[model samples]
Target chain A: MPTPILVVDDSVMARKMLIKALPAGWDVEITQAGNGVEALAAYRAGKAEVMFLDLTMPELDGYGVLETLQAEGLNSFVIVVSADIQPLARERVKQLGALAFVKKPVDPAQIEAILREYGIAL
Target chain B: MNDQLLLTPDQRDALQEVTNIAMGQAGAQLAQILEVFVQLSVPRINITESSSIATSILQLVGTPQSVTAVRQAFSGTLRGEAMVVYDQNGCRDLADLMGYEDDIDRDSERELLLDVGNVLVGACLNGIAELLGAKLSFSAPTIMAEDVEVGRLINPQQLTWNYALLVEVHFTLEVRDFTCHLMTLMPEESIVALKSALDAFMENL
Candidate 1:
């Protein structure tokens, strides 16, 4: 069975960039959410095993999603992708149980490396 | 101004670090959108009377006969107004680089100004908010003035605060010979919240 991946961000441009960065020939189904509320809904529906989350959005944000996931004990792997590249941001996301943090404008190599580190085979 | 000294060295340093990262992100986004290399200045942070913002901006960009400016206000956990200013020549040069025809008119120039403002100001504020772990919403960009002194563009009476915390950064496009300034003005009430937010961010680090 293909792995299910959820990409969440308020920016259409950012979401498209994340999708384009996925490794070639990866057998995965991709789901996209424009904000954290949608992301949580998708998560609840078992639509994603992995998520790429952005920190700032309209409704719930990346941190809110992480908090919700932790409160509910959801075990989905999360990799935060955001333009906010401050050291504090990285630390907070790590503390929130994110698998990794990647800065924006998304780099395909970085995404591949992160997926590899998480043992997601290309 | 005594109020300018409200931030301790450590707090100022932390704010500067956040501003630098935000400016970098904004520059990267602008570069991608315009297909040009954007050179950014070190961000400068200052607290001053709200009335002095225009004077400070003039000191940085010099007094020009005509200029184009865009302002957007943001509110949420952090609240501020961000403005982008460019001299007439700078705006013309930028429009040319963006593929505007040789005879660009006032309407086209205004459109160009707002488009750049939306990209740069929006990204920079979002970057800052992200760093502080706050969410912000921005008003639509408004063209404040054209063909006027930079200092005269802002109306003191309209500002909601007596004191302002200013985060300023400059961007230069060498290839296009265009330069512009971005200024974010956080009110005194907002600065209190910002300072606490900075402290929290630093403690976590």
Candidate 2:
């Protein structure tokens, strides 16, 4: 069975970039969410084993998603892929249980490396 | 009171470092939005009274009559406004590059300005806030003026603080001959918080 990955971002352009950057030849089913509300719903529905989250969004943001997931004790691994590449952002996401942080414009090689590190066979 | 005196050399350097990273992120996002390579100019930092903002902008663009401007305000631990200014001719060239049909109307031009402004200003401010470990709520971007004086577009009474820190950068799309300026104004009241945040960030580094 393919692993499910959720990609969340408010920008259509950013979401498209995330999908394009996914590792080739990976047995992965990708789900897309445009904001944090949809992201939470997607996660709760068991549609994602891993999530690529963007910090800035309408409705609920990445931080809000992380906080809610933590409160609910959802154990899915999160990988923050954001244009907000500040050190504080990286630290905060990691503290919130994100497995890794990837700066945007998402680099394919970097995504592949992160996936491999998280034991996803690419 | 000279607002410049409020920031130490170290604080200025730290602010510049943060601005550079933020601008880089903004540039990358902008390139994706426009499907072009963006050339970024060196960032210019100024600490001055809020009333002088228009003067500072005028100095950079020479005259306000040739530019279109968009403004958005953001608040949290930090509070400020971000403005995107594009030369009138540059705005038309950008619309052309974006594949707008010939005979672009006034409404089309305003929409284009707001679209670009939202992307660039929102990204830049979000980047800065992230660096400071702050969450900011942003106002909807609005087109302030089309070919008006910089002074006319800025109202001192609307500023929340008497002084501000301004970070400005110019982006040039060489292929299309499009150029625009992104300016972020952080008010004096927020500088205290910004300085403390920077100190903590530096300490962590």
Candidate 3:
């Protein structure tokens, strides 16, 4: 079965870029959310085995979503794909249980490397 | 129509996302300087007439009694004036950061704000230019207005362009009361280049 993936960002352009950057044969069924609210709803619907989240968003944002996930003990493998590259932001997301931080204009090589290191491939 | 805005709705969204990443770089620079985490709001894009530019700007920065602003001109593939607006409270916080909290006279206060404007505008504009695969250089930041009303902030006669595409970004210090707005105004011609760049960005995706 294909891995269920959730890609969330407020900008449609960003979402498209992220989807394009996914590993060539990741074998994942992808769903998208425009903001944190939609992201949570999708996660609750069991659509987020692995989640790619953007930091700055409308209606609660990625931090809020991560906090919610942590509070509820949700076990999605969350990778934060964000424009906010501050060191503190990276640390904060890690503390909130995110697996990794990837910068904007998503790099396909970087995505592949991260996936390979984590043994998250098919 | 000649009066039609350059960017379509789709283009605007791409431009905003591009700007958000650039703003993140600028915000990180600010966080390093102040040793405080910065909270960035989503970037807002608008295309408006020169006559009402200040009004839209005022609306974005909130309808405050007075505002201090620093303006710098960026020239190259993308050319425009970038303005950094700071409210009184934020200016006070900046004054403190600049170590002028003890005795900030008029000149020192102006210098302090210009100092911030210089760092932020240079970093942010460079980030945007880099992301768009373009090059840009900026003029020295200058104090554009000191505690002025919205109407007096920008004179329509001084604007050489009929329309400008404004990208407004706001950042607030996480632990302090410091807040500022970075607003970029690109004239119609630059918008054409920006539009092409935005299209190219989304082309392969």
Q: Please tell me which predicted candidate would have the highest DockQ against the true structure.
A: 3
Model 2 DockQ vs. reference: 0.04
Model 3 agreement with the true structure over B21-45: per-residue lDDT tens digits: 9988888888888777889999998
Candidate 3 residue pairs in backbone clash: none
Q: Write the per-residue lDDT of candidate 2 for residues B87-110, one digit (tens) a residue.
A: 878788878888887889988978
Off by over 4 Å in 3: B1-4
* Count of clashes, each model: 0, 0, 0
The TM-score each candidate achieves on chain A is: 0.97, 0.96, 0.97
TM-score of model 3 relative to the true fold? 0.96
Best by lDDT: 3
Task: Write the number of the candidate with greater lDDT, choosing between 2 and 3.
Answer: 3
lDDT of 2 at B60: 68
User: Which ten contiguous residues of candidate 3 chain B have the minimum total lDDT?
Assistant: B1-10
CA lDDT, every model vs. true structure = 0.81, 0.78, 0.88
TM-scores of the candidates in the order shown: 0.62, 0.61, 0.96
Model 3 residue B94 CA deviation in Å:
0.9
